[model samples]
Target: MPNSLRPSSRAAASSARSASLADVAALAGVSTGTVSRAMSKPEMISEATRVRVMEAADRLGYVVNGAARALAMRRTKTIGAVVPRFGSSSFPAMIQALEATLAEQGYTLLLSAPEGRREKEPDILRAMLERGVDAVALLGTDQPPAVLSMLAAHRTPYVQMWAPPGSGSDAVGFDEHAAGAQVVAHLAALGHKRIGFVGGRSKDSERARHRFEGLALALARHDMALDERAIIETEYGFAEGFTAMQEILGRRTPVTAMVFGTDYLAAGALAALDQGGIAVPQALSVASFNDNDFAAYLHPPLTTVRLPIREIGEAAGRLLLARLGGEHFEPPPMHVELIVRRSTGPA
Candidate 1:
């Protein structure tokens, strides 16, 4: 056969080539042993040499075969994370706190933001398990059955954040239902009998469902009912809140107050009320959940329920680490506070 008809050795090699420690070592002018040390025991190597090896690996798009390494060493030194989305300030800060805590013990965070795609969690967790992540950290308590099944099948240790009942023993979070009820109680105390709610659709977020249920229960206790037509469930976005507010107003229920599921949603509702020439507290009292970073800085500081998010993140990390280390850890109860700010007042 002619050279063109047969397999070309050069092209075949080019197509089959994948960067390995030997390749990285060659490019960085270091031994393969030194490259291995830089990757697995960077603390034992000089910082300058480690940086050189890392740069070379990056240039060659090299990823250590974590599965193979884990089988040999029995640990990946990684924690896999799954969350709804990182759009708001909360998820990033929460994850950052967890990362900081894990880093102390030489663990790295591998994250997946299913963002509007919560259904992908099972697949993400499966991939992480296959890659040999040592543990997993989940955002909400109400994980899907498939996700729970995959974890159980692999016997992968995991912990839940934003804790409530139904998350099993490894839950670490505050009272989401209590926070929602507290918002309503604050408004009810202010003599607002009629109220509307704007938040993420419950189908998309387990927390959203808990919050609404708590608010509804509180409303019933106060001799007030959540009007089906007045409830506006939308995306957890500013623009979504704006549109939701418009829809609620169009219902003509004439609710005296409005409760939002998140501070971002509350901020958007405030803008819509302003554009419509309605003054907060005087015309419509506004309050929300998650006293997130911007809650206290809104045009009229928002009244919201405060969640100890950083503490939650840190505790979840510590809890996971303890379990991984074969140490006992009991999660302390976290409380939520209702903050009364300028955005809300009397009916």
Candidate 2:
């Protein structure tokens, strides 16, 4: 009889009924040592023998203990993702795709949110490291010096997303600046000579800054400029958009059109304009970035720039995985385009 068949073995087997090396060996008519080798270093076993052992293990409800596997391999097949937030449709959809793709390679995705608050980044990274993440994904190109130092100290692979053009950072996203410029160019082509831009406050967002720079470049190209008084920078929110538009309306500049930093902002602008008795595209043209799903259903619809938001997230996942596996990667530059709609007309 096999060693596992001894009287003493009966209790041990019962205690670990979920399955054990001995159980697999017995079921496959092999030695316990052979089963151990098959579980730990499968390549050493013959293909026929390995398949039999694996099938027996499956029948016996055997699962490779990841903790023990990690200890032996010195690798944790988990990636960390740290983003500003994850409330929008784009983030969720991309994350779903990324998770599914990673699952194919037996990897797991660990997500963390700092809400664009720099103060929380270090703590969040520490937590991720504690969980033994193999790599990390960051948002935007302008990573803070402290975060960069943390990643370097651990020698962990990191990636940035939703970056600007010419960022000089390892990233995977479209040029936000160009997206903004497209909005400006569209407004200009619609015969709107005077344009007011509703922008997100740039204190914590390098992406927002790039978007504004692109709009400025577009204005300069048309021999026009944003009225300094009409430019309203507020938090990235609908209320902020509403208030920004109201402030622009308060200005003496005859605002023929208003470009917003995001679709959410545009929606708020629409509400404000409605309440103020100002007609859209007639009294004032409204445009925004990130052709969000909500943009299509707005009262007059939004003419905006379409962001490849889901693709950006999926790319971020692949980039992190490649780096974790010691694969060489040259992160691809992504591009965004303008989606023309009925939000603007001849001014």
Candidate 3:
């Protein structure tokens, strides 16, 4: 029997979708072998035939059986991404850059959001390996020791993102601590002291914690004290900012200025303060990290420290692509910028 007489690698996938390669071949007006050759090794087939076969496959909505291909060729041509969650602004941008870069070199991105930070890194690595991912990208470098050991054992190429100084793995990120410090310094230089901190939980994000620490360092430099009640932890959203502001408002001594870990939180604070009938910059000054797209749209606009998310994403894509191409390059520490805007003034 000809190789095409046997089931094609995509047969199982077709069955799952209730379609078949015969369906593709018949629709293409070509032989089964022609369809197989066109789909598997397009370079060996005539351009007209390849086009016809691809069009038919597209019309049929054929799905590639990555598992079978991985078994046959020992390559899945896919990279895995493990992040905190999907649909977030930052992760999606990074994924887009990575996917575009991989597609340019004939690869795909297989995404998995493990709900939250993986507590069992070993199991997570095992799951990706089981799926035959060529590489994996993790959101941060705060993995458990066993997870790091698992990666070393598998000898897979992995990249860690959003890291601080002295990262353990190959990484692409900026100094979160320095970013926080920059915001505090910017606020202080504008004559605002007695700062409050609003941010995400310290346990989940080392970067968030570092930002808070940077705030402390900057305040210390100015002989300022951040009140105990002024530090509020939220779940990295706008709602958290609102809650943090409520707590701040309830304080005995009102804060003069505030720095937040993210613009999302800052936006919440702005709304909360407005609802409380408090004036901004006159009664309270506010600054935040992550000079996100919406930062400039607020009533007074936000004074924010730029996170360099796009640059980091682009750089991450380039790094992964170069590695896939067998080229060696060191990952660089990207920098953050402070964008002084109207949200902050004398306090």
Candidate 4:
């Protein structure tokens, strides 16, 4: 027989009956209401009574049924957020902002990540929904179709972060395309004609694709074109960026400057360039997106676009709150700016 099915010496006492709130109240010499208040709203009861009720509950092994309480209130008072990844990115800071803002509103945040597998997003989202999350916040508009469909069917209030507003959904983010264009224009103004771009696969990320599109537009405006051989695509990581940079350098196309998808990747590329004895801003001017925490501390400092990650997260939380409150208003697009650091210069 399975261990669970086997009887033990304590089985008779355990199988007698599970403890209930009434049982706890009886032992504490209080009413069931008092016990309930002590567990749910301790401030409403005296400290001594709360302690007695708690002790009775502990003695009886009684546990509060959160699911029952949530059902009665018609809300779990919990918000969920799905991010792409966590470490070595701005997501952690953004999540912190979300948690802080939500806590102020008496709501808790449940965070989930796909662990680098886009296909696993739907399952993660489904799990959140099953847990009775009051609302959800998605990292970007580029969510899996199944996840979107499930969210729509569930009629859950949700907002998209890190993307522009007015996409038939509540969103709190800046225009990635515009930021990309600004970087390219800045490089062009510095007289970098032979430029290269190293980034993740465009198909996997709408933000990356928009940035690339913006770069293309800027290049066209400057009467220049991206060298086909100079474009390198890989996973979004420092090591990947380093390897991509080495590949771009080996192409013999004489790239005078480079643009990366993120500062993390830019840092990796910088390390690779340093190993090759290539001086930044002299041998190759480099720029990228997202002025992350480490962007300024880099050896030469990174010339990148600053995306207001924390602000976007707080705004996303507010948008969800507004949705829950049944308010209909679109937020204006957040602005991004180019930060000219030492990483890029005249080619």
User: lDDT by residue for model 4 over 311-331, one digit each (tens)?
Assistant: 887878878887887887566
lDDT scores in order: 0.83, 0.76, 0.76, 0.83
**Model 2 segments more than 4 A misplaced:** 1-64, 88-90, 251-253
lDDT of candidate model 2 versus the reference: 0.76
Q: Candidate 4 — what's its lDDT? A: 0.83
lDDT of 2 by residue, 75-127 (tens): 77887777775653246666676677676666788888656687888788888
RMSD of each: 7.7, 5.0, 5.0, 7.1
The window of 10 residues in a row where model 4 has the poorest summed lDDT is: 1-10
Q: Candidate 3: how large is its RMSD? A: 5.0
As a whole number from 0 to 100, the lDDT of residue 118 in candidate 4 is 84
Which ranking of candidates, highest TM-score first? 3, 4, 2, 1
**Alpha-carbon deviation at 101 in model 2, angstroms:** 3.5
* lDDT winner, 1 or 2: 1
Q: Residue 250 CA error for candidate 2 (Å)? A: 4.0
lDDT tens digits, residues 66-151, model 1? 77887798998999998776785377888999999999888999998876686788888889988789899998877889998988
Please say which candidate is ahead in TM-score: 3 or 4: 3
Q: Residue 329 of model 4: what lDDT?
A: 56
Relative to the unseen true structure, what is the C-alpha lDDT of residue 317 in candidate 4, on a scale of 0 to 100?
A: 81
Report the number of the highest-TM-score candidate. Answer: 3
**Model 1, residue 24: what's the lDDT?**
74
